[model samples]
Target: MKFEVGDKVVIQHSNDEGEVVEIINDKMVLVDVRGVKFPAYTDQLDFPYFKRFTEKKLFPAEKKPKKYIDQLPPEKPAPGKKKERIAQLADGVWLTFLPVFDSDEFGDDVVESLKIYLVNNSTLAFNFSYTLTYSGNSDFNLDGALPSMQDFYLHDIPFANLNDNPVFGCDFSLMTPDRKLAEHYEASLKLRAKQVFGRIEEIRKKGEATFSFKLFDEYPLRPYEEEKPVDTLGLGKLAGSGFRIYEASNGAAAYGVGEERA
Candidate 1:
């Protein structure tokens, strides 16, 4: 509602979620991130957004129960908490995300649809739209297949692949446009996938699979101010096709669709 000169806030208008780097006059505060500065009016803002962390893991020589892992507690312990830390680290604490991924062999495809569901659903609203394009390459693998990285996401929240297919899913950076919903949604998504699929990794197609759509992010109907162009991303160099996110607003994002700028 109100922003002081030095408050760290996330702009709901866009997902940049930068710190309130400086106050410019009475009406605007400049948020700077990654060497970029954006000035926004106080009226179009929210403050004190949540922070995010890369997922970490802890392990002790003994064994931790699946229930504890299943719980997916918000406060993850370090490699050790007790002398336990020593024991956990002594033998060697290997942070293997693949181990968790390896367990869910069955939900591989489900993970795909789930992420598509979340993104599509979340961006369905009138305020914003997200599109998934290929930036560097098209196919994640030579076979034109995706990594199948045990696609898992939360429920209640919505997501979609602009092209209407999902293969690899990514994390929502902390200052996501809708941080609260994204976090809760991702948590529930993580916990539920772990529970239902178990740790075993397997691939199963839930519904008919087909490439029905080409992914695209919506551009502003008309540009108003400094935020000039929209951004897009493509698959990547590995896939042999390149795309970038582009709109009248952000101009062109590094990633989009096809071999050209989307």
Candidate 2:
């Protein structure tokens, strides 16, 4: 495959699309990727353009479904207030939590719901278990895998009956395709329960039914420890109260069967 100095191409290894800017030799060329230029090999590149079946069409095209949102956008941030940051659970997976309202089945009533989105922002793919706990109790749980550059909804909790629960905890455990634990992330969100209710109540008094809020602020994910291996002989000693001495196959000292030395 020959590439010219102005051909648009994608790097096979990184999948980063760029255009050829300079040709150094037959094997290498300088590619410009979003204003950044890097040397790439011709064998590690592919052209983004192809001949179309219709001669009248100049470019190739593919069909994709459109995404539709039913809820209204959240209110803008006040002056001097910064925008919330995106939360990263792992190297690539991002987590976001927001409150929203949707119409009921009858279309006559507005129902409160919480929206949880797990976005796979990197090329790595993995599965995860998501657990949401509040007020010392479990609220919602989900288990699934997210593909590259995809977003998933974890849950949509009904907010109308958050009577005694406001503070919430979230746990995410990531696993590879073979089901081994890769990483774990946990965080807490303490909503201004009373103030949130008060604001909603005031809005209700004005005869409005649907609303939304960027409820939780960004939180950081910390490293979590994995489970430790248990000691078999130590378990036996705790099962009974006696002094004994014994040796195991691995040449480690162990408690004997009811033999007293002291």
Candidate 3:
């Protein structure tokens, strides 16, 4: 009756379905399917089957031109005097795709930001990824940084203004105030992060730290999006304690360590 990582479920009465994405807080599964991932409330999705596919079952459907989510109608790109889009890019059972070489300017900016966040938080030790929008340019391909940074920034939503719920997916904070600030930082990273970045810290870099966040009894992920592709966490059942952030991973059992499996 409960779903964990790797559960194949249809969307209630619909044929649309996917594997569980990462359990962001609790009672939610980040779902992955057809090369995209999203957050979904468990109750919203019905699971009538299990173990239908293996890690080996996953294979590239075919070769095609890599399209940017920005090109999609549902999503818009930054225009003149327009602010750039930046937010946390998450998919099911997060298997980090640290595409640092994904872009040129953004890639370097994120690396610089990560370093800054680490120093500000002072917890030390961190695991952050950048989104890389594939351009098919092998020579231009940072191989990793570009794409990763691209995706990371793509999901970089408004953290500064919490009154608007949240655009950024997840953020860690040693203290509530810090969490608020981190959330704000995420929101304003693209808008105004120079001064904000000056005052934060990272976990891994430090010996140890703890984090807390608002928990969700059930959260349905965004069903499809290329930039923030879906993931398959396969969380069969989750604890009410929600998710715990120790160091820099999802948790102790998450994907074997602080994160859901890919």
Clashing residue pair totals per candidate (backbone < 3 A): 61, 2, 81
Q: What global local distance difference test value does model 3 have?
A: 0.34
Q: What is the C-alpha local distance difference test score of candidate 1?
A: 0.33
How are the candidates ranked when ordered by TM-score, highest leading? Answer: 2, 3, 1
The better candidate by lDDT, 2 or 3, is 2
lDDT of 3 by residue, 114-148 (tens): 21111111222223332222232211111112221
Candidate 1 matches the true fold with a TM-score of 0.19
Residue-wise lDDT of candidate 2 within 212-247, one digit each (tens)?
A: 333222323343668888886585675566644444
True-vs-predicted CA distance for residue 218, candidate 3, Å: 36
Among residues 3 or more apart in sequence or in different chains, the pairs in candidate 2 whose N, CA or C atoms overlap within 3 Å are 244-256, 245-256
Candidate lDDT values, in order:
0.33, 0.56, 0.34
Instruction: Give one digit per residue, the lDDT tens place, for model 1 in 1-262.
Output: 6566567676564545666776544445556544445445566666543322222336536775557566776876668322111001112111111111112465342332221222221122322212222333333221111111111112212222323232332223222234233331111112233332443233223211111121223212222347644424433442465444345555534344334634
Compute each candidate's TM-score over C-alphas: 0.19, 0.33, 0.24
Instruction: Say what the RMSD of model 2 is.
Output: 21.2
Task: Identify the superior model by TM-score, candidate 2 or candidate 3.
Answer: 2
RMSD of 1: 28.3
TM-score of 3: 0.24
